[model samples]
Target: GAGVSQSPSNKVTEKGKDVELRCDPISGHTALYWYRQSLGQGLEFLIYFQGNSAPDKSGLPSDRFSAERTGGSVSTLTIQRTQQEDSAVYLCASSLAPGGNEKLFFGSGTQLSVL
Candidate 1:
């Protein structure tokens, strides 16, 4: 892809249902990140993958939330047993590399609605 791309720009799911959000980062980017933005709140870092290293999952809110990057390109964020509090815009960003002052390209985001 030309830039960071996310699928299912809008998703509505019932509480307790599981959902998967996909992201395709720029061709050469080695750093992919996932964030969540809730109403009236700031963007909260969820997870990040850097090259072949183990992903940083410390930012994930709970065990129900997990993300994985495949072949250093596409990434998927999965939320299990969704809750009302999970309703928010899930944003994906990618950078050239990690631990450096590099510019990050972000996708439009996937608005998840947990009803």
Candidate 2:
């Protein structure tokens, strides 16, 4: 895809189950980010990967949430021992580089439902 693509648009899991969401960014983009939007809440940054630099994970809500980008292309977000509060729309975005001036291309997102 020319733009960012995320798989499994909708997911329903039990409270204690673990889930993995995938994101495929644009082919040449060097910067990728993961964010989540909860009901009535703004986008929350979860992680950011830029080139070969260490990822910035300061925005992750909890220890249960983790993400990794491989070969600077595909990224995966994993939630362990998911809770009801973890339900949200997981969004992926990519840019040519990481900076305030760069425009980000975002995926439609994965809607997670924890029952």
Cα deviation of 14, candidate 1, in Å: 0.3
Candidate 2, residues 7-106, lDDT tens digits: the string is: 9899999999999999999989999999999978999988899964546999988999888877878888999999999999999999998989999999
Clashing pairs in 2: none
Whole-model alpha-carbon lDDT for candidate 2: 0.91
Local error of candidate 2 at residue 103 (angstroms): 0.1
Residue 113 of model 1, lDDT score: 97
lDDT scores of the candidates, listed in order? 0.92, 0.91
Clashes of each: 0, 0
Which 10 consecutive residues of model 1 have the lowest summed lDDT?
50-59
Over 10-94, each residue of candidate 1 has an lDDT whose tens digit, in order, gives 9999999999999999999999999999888999998889974545888899999988777988999999999999999999999
CA shift of 113, model 1, Å:
0.1
